[model samples]
Target: MSPTPQERRAARHQFGTGSDTPAARRGPSGGRKKPITVDAIVDTAFGIVEREGYEALTMRRVANALETGPSSLYAHVVNKEDLDELLIGRLCAEIDLPEPDPACWRQQIVSVCTQLRDQYLRYPGISQAAFAAAPSSVDTLRVGEGLLAILIAGGIEPQPAAWAVDSLSLYVNAYSLEVSLANRRISGSDDNWVVSRGELLRRFAALPETFPHTKRHAAELTAGTVRDRFDFTIGLLIDGLPGARRQP
Candidate 1:
């Protein structure tokens, strides 16, 4: 069944994609005030993105959510890119990085990366917004700066610490996106959506012999919690950063 408008609204909330504000009126003329804030529009845009994927996100849908016209939305938001930047900024605000600890910089990096992953999962469509942009907003830069400070404090040189911040952000964003997309596909499908690890292995077994490595390690591939996957990727990334120092 297609989701009802209320269901869609709730889904938006679950995804942390947008917020719905009470409508306001101007003067004695209760016809229509400029009925949208940049926050509201972006929040509604996020709702649209969560309901429909990024490719389907549109100003028209966002306006519909806010019960306003697209033209009004354009007054606050320029285009998809502008809206995306706003959404990314909103997502960045959710993360609160702690002080860089020189003694446990590796653990600190892992924690920051985990927080980024959790935030993206909480706000499903955010990765699509943050994908292309470098960290520019205060929150985004603050996270980057903390990561860099931790890495440098752990004895990494300046350039490599900077590079690690960029590299780490890219990995966290990209991997979380991949996981989110896969999850949506699984959850939204009606046919046999809840596959067990063994069932997944059976399905893999049915595939062609060309994917030899996949077949060989099918058990290991599907062998753990999403938390496990997150931790594994984080461990691998953190383990590799020390090597980045050699590149001068």
Candidate 2:
């Protein structure tokens, strides 16, 4: 006769050893065996980063969460870098790029950058993977390809179109990563976190005769909302684009 569901689970537990018996193999408080898969491991890794931050993510922790040996994780993923890449690829899958529009290519590029920032912000540990991911995976490349097509449609020359995709992606990734890192440093506390007006007052008080010019414009240094800063940077780059003056 075929093994019962309980027997099958026991054998799976036995495959790794130690916790092989039905009683030992019982789930947390004898609940149930959590199913395992590549996605399961990835999801668990995401949870680890979410709860403890990216620095705490490790194969051992993931194994502990799933009640399995770390060796089992290697059968599906190669190494920490590979797991990080997989996580980033999964995160990139969330962004939805607009179709190339010649009439509004500039706006389309900025819109895609905004979406990219939103995705990274939503997934806390994502920017860590992005640090070394310049070439990008299939999902990221699709967005780049779409942006390139949009630039080409706007009459940008082929060489500039190619460079623009890389340059714009770099700008967005670097800027967003910087902001995400800063936000992470602020304790997730409403009361303890720095208030804008108070922050300005502190800066104003710190300036002295040694830094007269800095004191004068301290308020301007930390003035705008993040959206305002993002718009300013993107606007500066758009204004400098070679094809900016081309007829639509």
- lDDT per model vs. reference: 0.70, 0.68
Residues 125-234, model 2: lDDT tens digits: 46777675654456556677777787887778878879877777777777766676567666565544545666776867687789887787777777888889988887
Give lDDT for model 2.
0.68
Question: How does residue 247 of candidate 2 score in lDDT?
Answer: 42
Looking at candidate 1, the ten consecutive residues that score lowest on lDDT are: 4-13
TM-score of each: 0.74, 0.75
- RMSD per prediction, one decimal? 9.3, 8.6
Q: lDDT, candidate 2, residue 185? A: 63
Per-residue lDDT tens digits for candidate 1, residues 115-224, read: 88887776565687787776554556667777888888777778777877777888888887877777776778654755778889998888899999888889888898
**Measured by C-alpha RMSD in angstroms, how accurate is candidate 2?**
8.6
Off by over 4 Å in 1: 1-34, 50-56, 190-196, 203-217, 243-248
Q: What is the Cα-based lDDT of residue 27 in candidate 1? A: 42
